[model samples]
Target chain A: MNSILSIREVSKFYGSYQALNAVSLEIPRNSIYGLLGPNGAGKTTLIRIINQITFPDQGQVFLDGEPLAPHHIAQIGYLPEERGLYKSMKVGEQALYLAQLKGLSRAEAKQQLKYWFEKLDIGNWWHKKVQELSKGMAQKVQFIVTVLHRPKLLIFDEPFSGFDPINAAMIKDQILELKEGGASIIFSTHRMESVEELCEHIGLIHRSNLILEGKLSAIKKIHKQNRYEIRWTPLNGTPAPEELLGRLPVIGPHYDAEDNTWDFTLELQDSEKGELLRYLSEHGNLASFRERIPSVNDIFIQTVQKQESHA
Target chain B: MHKLGLIIRREYLAKVRNKSFVIMTFLSPILLVGMIVLIAYLTKVNDNEKRLVAVLNESPFFKTDFESKRGISFVPLHGIGLETAKDSVLDMGYYGLLYLPQRASLEGVTEDAFLYTKDAPNTLVLETLEGIFEDRLREYRLQQLGVSSEEYARVRMGYEINTATFSGQRSAKGINEFKAVVGGAFGYLIMMFIIIYGGFVMRSVIEEKTTRIIEVIISSVRPFQLMLGKIIGTSLAGVTQFLIWIFSASLLMIAVMLFLDIDPAILMQRPGPGGLEASLAQSALSGDDTSQLLVEEFLKIPMGLLVGCFLIYFVLGYLIYSSIYAAIGAAVDNETDTQQFIFPIIMPLMLAIYVGFFSVFSNPHGPIAVAFSIFPLTSPIVMLMRLPGGVGEGGVPLWQLLASIALLLVTFLAIVWLAAKIYRVGILMYGKKPTYRELYKWLKY
Candidate 1:
């Protein structure tokens, strides 16, 4: 796999309290990696290490096959969770300043800022003070600043927060567009729906340890049980047979009186699936049937709970 | 290096562009000049009001002793009784009544004399009245002993011992103290600049932390660079303000002197309340040689060394103090939490000022002054107070001066290193109010 960033046995501590404990992961190139964890489970700390805002106690980080150093800061864009602009400064001036700090020349910063401001439909806000912008508008400005230099990697901590649904979707589209333009992304958030929608790979952190890290689809496939949902309507006015259903490994059987159909869930092994299908055909016509897929949210809660129980 | 320059530029612009800074820069000189003018006018009005004392004398001894002077006038009442004198004095709105009854002897006349007023009389007025009585009694005693008035006047003639340095140059009394005071003014200015601009550094740090901009900044530049940039930038703004104040105040002083039709040279030589100028003026009235020597002595002070040391101490001292300020700013989340840390930082400066003035005035070469001047924290101020004395022989010793500068530079570096550590850790920390113990822990980090 072509990886854009990799961490190996990175650990950090604040006095006696360990923030990260030998945690390690690789973020694939041109892929969105969801860094999932409960609050204060070392997600921010690890992200800070990646950004070089703080160094690790023990371990090394590499970006694009090279050791991470100060120069790599220019290659990464970080939108911290607690982010803001100089409230009294004009939007355009503040953006230019941030861009310049990120190693862009003045003229280049101005040109890029102009393009982003127009692209975000906030061109009129260039001369307005940041204090005059609403929270969502400010988020948009911050997003533009984070991506202005066209970094090789982008890290956003809860980027959707403080954004309304329509703006949030707009930002989501922009993130995908940036991915299409070939930038690796690390998304640290508790929102599983966005993760399900955007991430191709994920790492779950619990108690300062990476409990799971792999392709999102592969993890889901490994977590799924042989559970299937079935819907059928009785033909020829035949009543439902409770004994046969009870004999099988069936759960949550419900009969919809308006539609005259039976809805139920069944867990089956590979060999027993053919027998169940034949029985279902004889008893009533099979309306619909599909295997149930465990969502990222369910896997997250279940993994964390199982870890807690073991501890 | 380029990023540090950018940080410094931004910080300087932020401070200079602030409205309060601009207003204070322009308004302070006007306020200071107005206050000085008001004080001078008030002193003149106070000096103009002469107290009137009504003298009711039944004795023939003190007939001519009640002559008027600059601040007090006495009117003699020949036929009025003591009660009538008091009533008339009150009716005429006079300051007081001085009653002298007939006595058989000079001492007896003074013993019976009494001065009464509606309230406790002004001490100065009372002293003048008593001085007249005392002088007359002395004259009377001398006359009884067969000394004539002219001889008595000769006996009471004032005298002052001539003073000169061992180098055969005439030296006025209080000139050393005057020089020390002049140097102390520079020292005092340095302290104010450190405190005022150091406070700016601290508040600017706190502002960035509170606004959540510090992380973004430090990510682009080292925390040490940012802290140092802030100190240098804020001090530059302070220097700008100081330059404005000095320029405008001099202009205002010249205008006021011109409006009053006063010569600047005469004003410089004018006798102040009590100082080298007063004593020098007294001697200058007698001979041209002494006045020329006075001007020579004033010019002989090592002004070049004083100014050079001032710039050195100003930069180094401000760096040391403001780094601590920046550290404190980073350790806390808000301005209110800074109270606990500010006192220790200001204590050394206050000690330098008060102790420096006292010791440097009495004995510039004293051990106390030398020790304080060599100590890193207080040296910036106390050392300047001694620099006006010159360098090698009578002024600050060369070794002490070198040691003071070396220690200040070292202390500045060490403090900045420690401050940067705390700042690096603290800017990212939120919510909790950090303690000194926590700051120490951060230093390790």
Candidate 2:
């Protein structure tokens, strides 16, 4: 797939402290890519470089196969982690100013801002100063300014932060809508749940190295273990399932006295599933069977731990 | 170019909307002019000075009319000797007794008189008496000399110089002083505003750097553009205020001038306070006094030149210093850090104004004066005061002033160059104390 944004072996240093070390990543077009890392893991440095806020010491960044330059600044929208909206400025005015700075004509910016205002239902806040808004409400205004230009690439650092669950869900829906309309977003957040629900593809950087990078489903599958839980009931009053018990590795099989139901974990040990199923059928009726798949959080912790332990 | 226009518009609108700027602009000139008028009004005519006389002559010739004005209360001492009159005058509340001794070759009792007092009279005291005595004496002379007032005026030959220079310049030798004083004050005020407010602009830049707003702005616009915009904007504010001050000051000045007893037309028409008429009255009776030797001639001569020089210095001087201040602002992040840089900027302004004060009345065209006035940094202030008095006359060539102005322009450009470089970097830097050495390093980058 063609990459919408590319950083080729990027490395940056701050007067002796290394921020990013030969980090390469590609964000595919029309995809929501999660840039995952712990604090001080060069996530912000890479974001800043992509935004052209600072130049990297030893790397190049490209947008849509072209080298990044000032004019291209108009093509990318950045909502920095530390939201900086002018405190005393009215919300609508500030948004228009920021939009114009991104190279939008005043009339066009106003038009786009009007639609955003209506969509976010913040039309009443147009005349209110930003300082008067709560942190979450201001975030909505900031989000509007960030996307007012309809940038081809939007970088949101901690986009869901300071948002209540309802607002968070609202912003998530808007992000997905933007992504659907052909915008590629680099979503940076330490919140793994956000990554799980929002990002289709992600690159996990632990200690300045990319430990895992792939589709969300594929990554989970790569780290999956084959383990299943089974719940059953006896057909009659007989507990004569000796062959089935011997063949299967049952972790725990306890009968509930009140319900007469047996629940147990089954681990396959070189035994064919067809043979095991026939043995179980002679003694009891199987009520339920399901495999436990690893969650994204579990995979993240495991990968980070593995890398840290090895290092 | 459009960006510059946008920037200028922001400055203009923001400053115009500020209430303090509007109020100060209109108030300062009014107060300044009102103060001048107030001083003139408060300077009341003295009303309590009595004179004692012990003229030894018993003849009516010794008792010639000594017409008195408001302050003078004259006491006659006919037939009294000088010693008795002096002693008697001390007991009374009189300042002194006039001691007129007889002269055998006199053309009538003549007119001049002398007085002794506890101390020398103040200018007001001396001026009042001198005016009254001269008026009465001139009448006596016109009669005794067998000449009408018109014939005596014609015969006196009133030495005049319809002054014309080699350059075909016909000059008004009169009111030359008043013009010089006005010009010097004008130049001084303009220079003062530029320096004081220019520093404000620099401080504003430093404040922005301290706050780190520069990073956000510089990301969008070039560093040079931002700094240029701020400086130009602040200067425009100052200019607006200055124009308002001038308009208001002129109005106040006119109002005050109306109430002042100082009409140039009136003062000019009347005989100069204590000059020819008083001197003639004194010399006619007391013989020519010889104590007027030490008056500085060149110091008082060219009021016109000083005034002309002041106008040139005011604008050029302000522009020159303002550029440096702007550069200094760009070099540092805060006022505390500016302490080191400030000395270099302030020393020239201080010296120039100090020199201006002295050069106003001293040898305005002395070699030292010429050097300071032409020196680009100090010229704006020094030449303003010096030019009025014709200091260093032939030495002050046109090319020199032009050269100074040209040099100021070049210096302005250089300041902007170095300032822009530092402004770009310094504004983005946070939480660091910038040293002089570090500043140099930033310039290199």
Candidate 3:
């Protein structure tokens, strides 16, 4: 895969405190990369370095395979976590001003702003002061300004914050659309569900270190326990014999008295799924069977907990 | 550089389009001129009010001396004691009762004379009463000396002293005081502009920092570029407002002069009230052709040079001070925290005005004035204070003026360099307030 942005052994420090310690990551082109971390885990530091808000104390950052320079700021869009607009300024004018600041010509800025405003159904709010808009409406304006420059890389820190569910979904759709249009995005959020829905690649940062980094599916697969859940019922109104149940490779079995159903989880160890299915056929009627894969949330929690306990 | 232009444009448009800016730009000059006109008219009206005074003269020496004038009308009381006269005066609603006691000598007559009123009479009324008594006494004394009152009056005129320099250059007696006052006014203007516009730049910085728009802005533009753009943009707005004030004030002054049917040259010839002219008026009246010389001396002032220097100093002074103000704004989270940092920046400006005025007024060529005028921190004000005196043996040297300007320019660049460092680091800092030591560390960063 071609990486649009490469952070190589970048480190940052604030006074005596280390914000990022030898952190490195490759953001693939046209992919949504989730940056996962607890508060103050250096996600913001890395993002700021990429946006050139602040520079790393050591190491280097490369954008499009070139050493980062100030001019490269035009190629990246940043929506900070503490997002705001000038409250007294008219929405359209302020947006136009910011877009022009990002190296867009006035005509191009106006055209892009118009298209975005129309798409977001905020065309009527062009002349209204930002103070007059609801928080969600102002967020829509901020989002529009961030993307109006058509940048090659977009960085959004907690983009879904302060957004209602409907607006969140709308923003989510827009982000996906931007990615589809060939823009690489760095998505930072605490919402694992959204990460699962949106991000293709992710880097898990803990204590200023990137502990896990890869494709989302691959990471989950590497951490998988190979556990399967089974639901069985008696065929002749007789329970399965205890001896037959003992012969099966199972970890925990649960019985439901109200429905007369047997549910159990099995860990595959030197046993094939087809053999287990054949054994269950002579004992009882198999209702359902499915492999259980750990969710992103579970993996995140487990990884963080494991690191904390080790520390 | 292009982004700097965009930033400046954004700042300029934002400020110029503000409603408060528009209103203040137009309204302040009107208010200032209106206040002056109101005070002048009110004083004139107060002087025109007529007051009645009842005079009870027990002395047989003077009866016709207490004649009535335009604003004060005197009524004689016959065959009435001082107490009855006072009662009748109060009952008749007179403004005051002037009682002249029977005395054998002029000195005793003054000691015995008393004026009683419901309230303390103004100095004008008191001086008028005293003048009448003195004139009568002088006439009586001249008759006793066997000389006519007219001859004595001619002889009583004071002697005049003509002033000139050792080089035989005919100079006005009070020219230094006049030039000092004029220069002081220019200095005061520079001080006022720095204070007002420096606060403006600081407030603009604080507004952007507080609103969190600075991050988005500095992402595209360097912090130094952003700071310079804001300073230049706001100064342009300040210049616009100042120009409007000057235009409107001049127009209003002209209109007022026309409405009052007063000569513009007369207004220019005499400095305003509380000026050196008021103190010198007595000496000027005693001297031969002093008013004409005073007017000539005022005209001899190098107004073109003074105005040019004022513009240069105003720009340089504002640039130096506003950069510091911008740094303070970046270093702090709010205006309250600015107090600790602001005092040091403004101390020199305030000191310049106070020390410049005193030193220039007393001795225009004194070392203190020269030192302050050459020091970059105080030069904008002190140099203007010395400009009207002219450069040579008696005033500021041309080399000193150029050096002051050069030093101010150099200082401005150095300050901008230092301030940019603080601004770059401080704009993103939140929560913790910074100290002077911390700011020093930011310089290294």
Give the alpha-carbon lDDT of every model: 0.86, 0.68, 0.84
Shift of residue B309 alpha carbon in model 1, Å: 1.2
The residue-by-residue lDDT of candidate 1 on B229-310, one tens digit each, is 8888888899899999999998997798779754444323332332223334554455655556557766888888889999
Model 3 stretches astray by more than 4 angstroms? A234-252, A258-260, A270-274, A285-288, B54-92, B97-121, B131-155, B166-168, B260-288
Local lDDT at B285 for model 3: 66
Error of 2 at A55 (Å): 3.5
Alpha-carbon TM-score of each model against the true structure: 0.92, 0.67, 0.89
Report the C-alpha lDDT of model 2 over B373-422, residue by residue, as the tens digit: 66777767665654443434433566666766676667666766776666
Residue-wise C-alpha lDDT for candidate 3, range B1-445, written one tens digit per residue: 8888987887787789889999999899889888877766665665567789988888765667777775788988889888888898999999999888998876677778899999989676877776676666767778898989788767655556777878776787677888888988888988888888889889888888888878777777788889999999888888888889999999998898779864444323332222223334544464657767878888989899889988899888888899899999999888898999999988998899889767877787788988898899999998888889787765688889889999999998899889888888888888778989899987765
Better by DockQ, candidate 3 or 1: 1
What DockQ, between 0 and 1, does each candidate earn?
0.61, 0.14, 0.54
What's the residue-level lDDT of B365 in candidate 3? 75
Number of the top-ranking candidate, with TM-score as the measure = 1
Show where candidate 2 strays beyond 4 Å.
A9-23, A36-48, A56-58, A82-91, A128-139, A160-169, A190-192, A201-311, B44-196, B199-216, B255-344, B355-414, B437-445
What clash pairs does model 1 have?
none
Give candidates' CA RMSD values in order. Answer: 3.4, 8.8, 3.8
What's model 3's lDDT at A91? 94
Backbone clashes per model, in order? 0, 10, 0
* RMSD score of candidate 3 (Å): 3.8
Q: Rank by lDDT, descending?
A: 1, 3, 2
